[model samples]
Target: MTEIVGRLAPSPTGALHVGHARSFLLAWWHARSRGGRVVLRIEDLDRERVKPGATDLVLRDLEWLGLDWDGPMLRQSEDEEPLRAAVAELLERGSVYPCFCTRREIALSAPHVTDGEVRYPGTCRGRFASAADGERELGRAPGLRLAVEPGELALEDGFVGPFTSDVEREVGDFQVQRRDGALAYQLAVVVHDARQGVTEVLRGRDLLSSSARQWLLQEHLGLPHPTWYHVPVVVDEGGARLAKRRGDATLVELRERRVDPRALVAWVARSSGVNAPDRIGARDALEGFRLDAVPKEDVVFGARERAALG
Candidate 1:
């Protein structure tokens, strides 16, 4: 049997919050408990949102929680060769086409879905013969979008169980590369997962929709799919998901208040349906870790939870 490989990928767009803590701790527990190797990857490719010194804070918080990973940490921006190669391969295989539609144009063409995604209507599909043709005709650079086929793609998530999605109907042809020459998240994540030999993926359920599109890319690129686990996400009292931009119960705030990291770990463990002491190390909570025991509903993070952490 192949050794299980997992990843702790965090975007340095903002400070780590309690919501992030829960997800990271669960991910750490899930991998470490099974004696698996966990690779750390900094997803800072979104230069527009990447915060200065945010990466250091993320590292600091992870260390504070005693979430250790194997091997050297990777930055998505550190290497562009693999990303470029993946895009090139897709282009060569005719799996993708140039998209010249701007954001505003796409938005005006359709209403935003519940997940805040606008199901792309294949606006630029076959609109141009090539990237050069798109630029020549539109007088601007063109992004690359996968020519998604219309059909349902099913998957069995390690945690969420059976799931299905039709990328074409849900999101249509999605972009692999942006017009600004940046590799989109879907493409970047697939390339990184393949290159790092990640055998399992455990993250927030909010990204569950992405698995279908990623599966398509994997098949197109001949890359293997990893075991998927889309666990529940932490939301505020109002049921709104926490965002780094909102400064919602940040770990930094807790640290400044002298809140014990172990306390936070205990809270996370309990929230995930595990019984833990008032203060417990992340590793200590892994003794009888079971994925099935984790709650399927979104975990609430509000005043009561914060008070408990202190």
Candidate 2:
């Protein structure tokens, strides 16, 4: 049997909330079921937003949740050289181009719509220019953008099934490197996953659209594409999705409140209706749990649900 490798790549920008716990649980379960290795990767490339001690909080949370991962934890910040190398290779091959347009310029100059994010309009595609032959010493600070070809990028999601996205229609040419000298999420994630041999990706359905773009980048970089599984996202009573920045109910908070780890695990399982709320421990709950049994609908995390867990 082929080794099944899965990963939980979380940004160390805040505490790991319940939604993040669900994502990690799913990834861990998938890897354990297959007797595969689970990698813990810290996606802290956003230097400006990453808070001090956030990484330690993440590690403590995972350990508190009774999760163990193989190998030393990987940090994206330590892998910037390789990421830049990948960007440079793509630029030299004409697969990527330099973008000088700022976000404000693109927003004002293009017919962009807010599809939960600021969509880019291929405003700089025609204006893109290659580096001069003798300008090899121009350094790695150039803002590079991946040219999304005019075609439908498709992927077979493990849970969501068939998914496709017209990159030009949905999101125009996106950035691989920002003008501020930071690596973009889409580019960095693909590089890290490929380099680490991640065979499966388990994330929230909210990221399904972005997965299409990553698939495009994977092809351009000739990297091995991993199977994707997008789990349902946890929402609040108002149907608003939980966010790390929005003061959502976090695992650390619940732990501080003396909520049993097993109970929290059971809550996650119950949210998907994979197991009853009476499930006692992680091993039992996970043993009876089936990935196919998880509901595709959004799981609401209201006040009543919190009270029930306690």
lDDT by residue for model 2 (104-178), tens:
777777765746565677655655244432134444344777887788866699999997888877878888889
lDDT of 1: 0.89
TM-score of 1: 0.97
**What clash count does candidate 2 reach?**
0
Instruction: Estimate every model's Cα lDDT from 0 to 1.
Output: 0.89, 0.82
Cα RMSD (Å) per model? Answer: 1.2, 2.8
For model 1, residues 1-310, the per-residue Cα lDDT tens digits are 8989999999999999987888888888888888889999999999999999999999999999889999999899996799999999998999999888888898999785637898888888877667787788779988889999898987899998898898888888999998888889999999998888899999999899999999999999999999999999999999999998899999899999999999988888887878888998888999957778998899888999888776
Worst 10 residues of 2 by lDDT: 132-141
* Each model's total of backbone clashes: 0, 0
Q: Candidate 2: which pairs clash?
A: none
Runs of candidate 2 exceeding 4 Å displacement: 128-142, 276-279
Query: Distance from true position, residue 173, model 2, in Å?
Result: 0.7
